[model samples]
Target: MNLDTPIEYLKGVGQQKAELLKKELGVYTFNDLLQHFPFRYVDRTRFYKIREVSADMPSVQVIGRVLSKEIIGEKQSRRLVAQLKDDTGVLELVWFQGIRWADKLVQPGAVFIVFGKPTEFNGRFSISHPELELYNPSAVKQGNLTLQPVYNSTEKLKQSFLDTKSLQRLQASALEIVGRSIQETIPDYLRSKHRLLNKADAIQQIHFPQNPNSLEAARHRLKFEELFFIQLKLLRNKLLRTGKFRGLLFGQVGEKFNAFYSDKLPFDLTNAQKKVLKEIRQDTQKGIQMNRLLQGDVGSGKTVVALMSMLLAIDNGFQTCMMAPTEILAKQHYASLEKMMGQGFINMALLCGSTPKKERRIIHQALQDGSLNILVGTHALIEDEVQFKNLGLAVIDEQHRFGVEQRAKLWRKNSVPPHVLVMTATPIPRTLAMTLYGDLDISVINELPAGRKPIKTIHLFESQRLRMFGFMRQEIAKGRQVYIVYPLIKESEKLDLLYLEAGIEAISREFPLPQYRISIVHGKLKAADKDFEMQRFVKGETQIMVATTVIEVGVNVPNASVMIIENAERFGLSQLHQLRGRVGRGAEQSYCVLMSGNKLSREARIRLQTMVKTNDGFEISETDLQLRGPGNIEGTQQSGVLDLKLADLAHDQHILQEARDAVIRIFEDDPELNTDKNVLLKEYFLRKTPAISWNKIS
Candidate 1:
């Protein structure tokens, strides 16, 4: 059978087993089965004695003879228990689910080899459902048990008799069909230059390695292949877009930009900000659409850069639109920009779900008449009824929150799509950015604005609430506000309200309402009510704001000097970093108090320590990447950019770099993969094209 043969047609995997393979592992064809590489390999060369086995050990192998076998318990709970003895001690082997099947393979006097995890219960050691194989002296003499590959299997698959061992057997049978038949996908010259293993040998060694060195080589080759293809795909799209789409040229920075930069500038732009602005100017100057991703730490003046870019568009007689994910953030941006612009000739408007009908009519008239130079709003900006007259640039804040289709809708607003500048406060790790946003040009605002004091982070236990409250009082006495953020309890809103009530009560008892005006906000509150509470805090009507993570994204309170994160351990490092960012926006010295429980996990401790140590968002991001893999990062898994099987973004940075460089060389030499050397590459890419272009979404 060929590689394209259905898996059910294979030797060991019949229709029933094939369904299990497809359902559990997503393996459909013979080739798909072959590519399902083992997660780990075990050495069967050495056998451990029963006395040497421990609870902390991974799966271990031991040569033993079954001393006694018994069927214990009644129906439904019935199990087959066998007492196995090596040289030193006796070990109990129990099978809970497959007692009938296991009772056949193992017997009282049979000499067998057992492999499984060991656990101690009630002062006795037992191995539940150990893999037992008949022991043959000649098999050890022939070195047949040197290495064993273990495939991941689901419990359902195991119930259907397709366990890990069954999967391995099926894989071996599929490999036999694929033996020496696999053709090299990469060009021979590139393989030679990179010292990569051939596709056939790599596949074989990956599944059943003859030696550890071969296994490592196979891993390197496979990882390189996976990353190389991803880079190639992203780079190819970038090239195609640049070649095909001509951007509306903002020829020069004119009146509006010059006026904003020279006359109405709020603060001097940091060098980091200046550099990013320069890069953006260069992109807009070129006659190509700019799909640039601007990454910066919270409070790194990203909104300022965005404003300057919008002004650039306005200077060239075109309108700009900024879309935020939420109405609160949209209003915040509109307010901040309005305050910054300060009654200029340039007109700006805010369009959100809550915008008054009169204001919406005015915005629509101004937009249609080309009088509105800039519009900032939420998803309402992309509504069919709201259209732009001369939309030249679109700036998306927290770009990950929008889907590809939503962004595409914005692109269609203009015949030639406007220059798209997507900004994020969450600092993406360099490697992750390369894979996730490789198609988009990236600019990082790495420095905080000058004169901004680094927020001092402190970790305190629940017992230290009194001290935290005292510190809050001191900060409030300085005429500054404090934000107390609580984690959301999704299990029950009643329980959540109880937690919020308890916190509010404690704060009221400590800093009473008449003495301290405290506002409460959460997701449970209605939109208008939430806004009312938030406005009170922002307007400085309240001395303290007790809220949930709803305030994490776009709340800007310059007067707020302290952020007290209750149960900080429940928050991710990135979330903690974002909450910490809320307070340090002002020029005054700020503090972030991370209150957690007495007991902390190793990861939790690292997160707290990292927060307390530095204010670098990139550093915090890297630590976060390590602590909670790429999948758990905000919106990344949903983006499908990190849908990797084997090559880990956390650990394979070097491989990724190498693969990216290789892609660059390939494109530089042959942009269209038209050469004979790259025909295989083109075919492979065509065969594996994803159903959705995930990168375009972000």
Candidate 2:
């Protein structure tokens, strides 16, 4: 038997059991099971009598005889109840599930060893769903007593008689078959330098540790290995792209860029923006493909920087394309460009899924004929039919929404890939960015443009609704519009749509017709209808815009000075920050009111508190990372790259840094990893390289 052997061949796991294992735990082969590391372990060295078991104990192992067993109650409330007795006292065994199976195992006058935590009820102690095994004095051996591994399993697996104990038995059998055959993955020199345990020993110790010290050693070695490979992949991708890829050279900053900077400029260039432009210019001037990630907070002038970068491409006799995630965002960008450049100074067109067929044909013709200098669109931009005549640079807005492949399609447009500039208003923590976007060079536009006031953020309980309404009235009285947003549009079942619909009604009553006009929007609305409502708010024809979080990343309504998010506790921190960003776009002193019920979970409270404490998206993101972990933060870049089983970004940032440093050190000595000392590392990557996905482009 080997790592590649099907799991059904294992002693206890037959065809039926293997199917359950695969369905429940995603384990189908011996190697998959081996890598299914234990979430925790339990000490099973001591035994206790019934008298020794107490309510305060975490768990106690007791050898006792079952006095009686029976199934009580009917249907949903049915349970298997049994009585067990030792020399001193009796313990109750209860099973809320698996009643028939448990009843058969628990027979009267049968002696068994039971293990579970004891709970007190009415002056008596009982153990629920305790681990039970038939006691055999002769079968028990000294070597068998060790730390028992507790695998993360499902209720279905348990019902199929594959509980933690069953999994442990299967693991033991697996180790016996593939024991010493487990090849060393990391190099011996690196292991020795890091004081890590050997691969075989680490894998063995992790599953069935002899002692706590050994378990700790195993953990360190395995965690290091996991993170090391990730860093190696990221660094190597960067090394390869920078070394092999050629970029289109933009030798001069010409008429369009100069005209925009001097003639059409709206605001003075912030220092941060100037610094970032310098970086982009340097990358494009040199004949190296630029894969850069531009990060900034909302209203921090990322769009201005993006526009200027595109202009640089245009100035150098090359075309540019800017892609946004939604039609609303794409139109907003096109409008900004139009307002800045005026009509016909530079030919530009917008293409979306909803664009009229005739306009699409004209835009397509312009792109191929070299007349379209800049094309702005949603995912439609990546479609095969649309082609650029001389695409030099590609700017992606809210870039995390696009997959690596979708972005790669833009690179595939030209003979040599364009200089890629990825922009995101959602803040990514340093550690997460290093792991996810490590291949790309990063620039931060950290400060807002001049004359923009810091948005005032406030947290309010449901009881303070009237006060929030009063503040909104005051803001609207100043000729500024108000945005009253509900939690999420996706969960129309969560009654949020109901809340938004009812909210518009209530607002109609509060500040009745003629005096006030409210525009309603959500995902369910038709595209034309949504656009109509959005335009109403933008044009200041409506004093209030009531909608779901569909307004999270869209139109810039500078007149919308107040943002009131109802049921704010339901939203994630990053999202809450993004929603708050909707109102603060204008020069007026904007306010974000987060409204929630009085009762809140600890996590919910922390999220609300973080929003109120600061407008810094990065700090809020760090706290959000700590609270919701890396996977769910603002629907963090959905890529297979972050499918980590063990190492956590929140708690293991130090280890990640150390691992990254180690990779950098390796590349310094042998960038190609072709040296004799690094031969093993080279071979490992070669063996593991199965058609690469993310290694090609950022």
Candidate 3:
């Protein structure tokens, strides 16, 4: 049978069985049937004598003859007790709610090989309902027994008579077909160099490992191939992007950059930002389409670096557009940029979704006629009707929020594709950054701006709420605003929203005087209402704003100095950091109070400790990567920046770098993967990309 052949077309698989297999195991094709690897294996080679069985051991197999068997207890909670004896000692076997089955399986004076964990009950050794196999005296002679493969199966499948044994039969059938049809993908030299196994051997060993060493070798080969092909794909995309798209050469606008650095700013820009800006300036002037990622901690002067890039664009006689995810953020950028550039020198317009028709018409006309040099907006900037005069630079904020298509849409705004600069306050672990943005050049603003004090982060239990309240009161009395954030958007049937609503009500009660204003915002509130509350907080009308994660992204209030996240254990590390970022925006010594619930897990404690020790987003992100792995760096939807299978963005960073280096070497030598050895790599990419249609060039 071919790889694509239906399972029913194979021998012994009937229509009913095939449908059941498809529903239960997702095994529709011969290939799918062959690739269902076992989750674990039992080393049947080691057998423990009945007398040698221990209570603490995970599992043991023992041979013994049944001495007695009896059913006990009521109908609802019936149990069977069987006393088994070997030459050395006796052991009790118990089964709950399966007395009839147990009675039939263990007949008195019958020898059986049983496997399970042994426990001490009433100072006697006992096994609770062990898996049994009938012993045969004729097959007694043996060395080490073969390991038994344990495939993952559901109870429903077992009830339908499609248990592990049934699945194994189907697997045996597919193995015969696969043995004939499948060809080896890895070449010999590289296999020998990496000390890897052949594809067929690897697949077989993965499903039914002969030993632990064999399993390790098999895993290494498979994982390496998976990562290698992914790297090859990304490198190819990078090559195509860099070679084909030409960028406007904004030669060393160091004069403009230095002017802002040397004189204009109130506080000195960090060395990291300056270094990244230099890199960006060099890339923009090289006449190659610069696709660079500017990663930084919150309030690290990324905005200033982005502003310098825009200035470079303007100095080179081209217009720039900085797009934020939200209208509030767009307005924030517009205001900030206006203040930085001082109005009319570079005509900036705000063309958001909420922009009035008349104003939008004016903005559209201004954009088309080259009157507008800078435009800040949401997705409204990428609308088909919104044309640009000369869009040389496109700076996207919070890059993870936009997908390849969304970014590509903006790229299409300019005929030649504007040099893209994606910015993120969310510090992605470096390894993840490589896999996620392998095609883009990365520049990290690793240092905070000068004189910016690190946010003092503290963790507290639920019982310390009163102490936290008192601390907040002191902070507010010192003329600082406080932010109390909750995890929920609205009340749910499953989750209690008592903490959220209670926090709001409690804060309102604390500040009962009319002079003190308290605002409440959450996902349940209307967008306008949320915005209004945020505006009040930003304008200093509200001394405190109790809200949810909806305000985590870009609801900036520089004056707000205290952030208290309730039940911080429920939120991820990166998220808590983002919430913490809401404070520490201004020069005041900001503080973050992480109120956690009882029963903190090891990982949870590590997360809290990481926050307490460091304010570096990059470091926090790295710690997060180590803790959670790279499962949701780009989020769940396909629209997120990075989505990968098998590759752990956090743990596999080193591998990613190695793979990237390998790709570079391959390209330097061959340019295209046309060599005989690289054919498998190409084929591997072809096989994997169909799911994402990543192979299709558009």
Candidate 4:
């Protein structure tokens, strides 16, 4: 048998089982089934007497004879119950969901082995929906108990009689045929050096381990293999792209850049900003394609560094463009650049979807005529007609918000493609960044600018509303603006909007009219109306911006000192971090008030406590990863690069780092893997490389 043999042909996996496996688990061939490792394992050697079972025990295994079996309850609520007894005492075993098939397996006077968590009700112990099998002395060994693999299954699969035991049996059957035929995927020398098991042995032991030591060895081998391949693929693509693509060399800091540094600069560049610029300068001058990810916290000076980099491109006689996820943000960037650079000195224009046809026509003409030195806009900047004469640099803000195809369209604006600088305010953990954007060079501005105070975050219960309002009044009395944000639940936007509107009404009644102005924004508003409401907040016409999370990203008001997030427990750690970020942009002390209900879950309490503990985005991000897992972390989930099976980003950082280092060493010795020693590694990646569009990663 071969790895590619159809799973349907495997013993015990008939057509129906094969179809179910393929639909529920994505298993198509023997190779896929072999790779479907168990999520957890249960110890089978130790069996407990009925009296030993306690409610506090996690899961217990007991072997007992069935004393009585009967069906209880009426239709729909019907269930099967059996009284099981051992030498110590009697225990109740019950099944609520699957009755017919369960009735057949359970019979009076029959011996059985069962495993499940024990629960106490009415001074008696019982196990519900426990896994059971007919007790056979021949199947039991004389030595210590061994671990049994447990596979994840869906309700449909369980209803169809394909439980974890059935899956384990099917895997064992498939292994019997292909164990001898399987070949080593990793090289012999490297496997020996790393003390890893061979591919076949690891696969066998992972499914059915004989001991704890073998299971650990099997896990190490599989995790190492999984991570090593991912790192190798990422590094190989990076090397290939560097060799294939040539960039516009900005060889000198010409007049434009120099003038901007000396004349147009607002403040002294922070050490972090200076270091990032040096890295960008080096990449631009090297004449290799520059795809860099710039990460910073909320008040960090990323905008200035991006603007200065654009000046380097302009100094080299090439035009530049910046794209933001929202039109409000695009407009903000356009305005900030215009104010800082002076209008006529560098011809810049905004080309969002809201731009008028007449102005767009003029901007289009100037872009073709090589007069528009810089352009800032939303996705509208990538339109077919929006062409640049000499696009040398393209800076994307909140880069994860745009899809790979959308960003790829910007790259195609020029024949050779411009050097890309993708920036994000949501700080990515180092391990996540290396895996998600591993092909791109990463530069992090870890320090906030001088004189900016860290946002002081506090968690308050809803019962403290009067005190919260008093604090808001005090901040407003100090001539600082406030933001009151509400969450939008998916079940009902109208209900959420009603809550937001009610918040506005309550705030207006408290602050009362002539002395205060309130502006609201939400997803239901039209684009123009939303922009107008945002403008009112920016212009200080409104002392308070009462809105939903619509104001999460782009609204930047330096005068805004307080952000009160109502029902903050409903927000994720990342979103809560982002909302906290909205406040601390200005130089003066700012505060983030996380208003949650008193009855918060443990996870929600941790999120709020994390927020209250640190203002560092990276720290909050790591906590968020721990609390929510990598799949829920915003960009990594959608990137399709984090589909890890055995290697976890949170727990297995050491393995990931080792994998990356090994790839570097391998490539340093054999760049193309053309040597005889590395031929197996080359063939392995080639065989496993899926049709992934790596270009959109930037």
The list of candidate 1 runs beyond 4 A from truth reads 11-24, 49-52, 64-112, 120-129, 132-146, 179-183, 489-498, 690-698
lDDT scores of the candidates, listed in order: 0.88, 0.87, 0.80, 0.88
Among all windows of ten consecutive residues in candidate 4, which has the lowest summed lDDT? 489-498
State the lDDT at 589 in candidate 1: 95
**Tens digit of lDDT per residue, candidate 4, span 252-361?**
89898899899988878899999999999999998888999999987688999999999999999899999999887898888888877886878899999888899999
Clash number for candidate 1: 0
Worst 10 residues of 2 by lDDT: 489-498
Worst 10 residues of 3 by lDDT: 636-645
Candidate 3: regions farther than 4 A off: 11-13, 17-26, 42-45, 48-60, 63-67, 84-91, 108-111, 117-128, 135-159, 162-165, 252-263, 634-647, 650-654, 683-698
For all the candidates, what are their Cα RMSDs to the real structure?
Answer: 3.4, 4.1, 3.2, 3.5
lDDT score for residue 57 of model 2:
86
State the lDDT at 374 in candidate 4: 93
Choose 1 or 2, whichever is better by TM-score: 1
TM-score of each: 0.91, 0.89, 0.91, 0.91
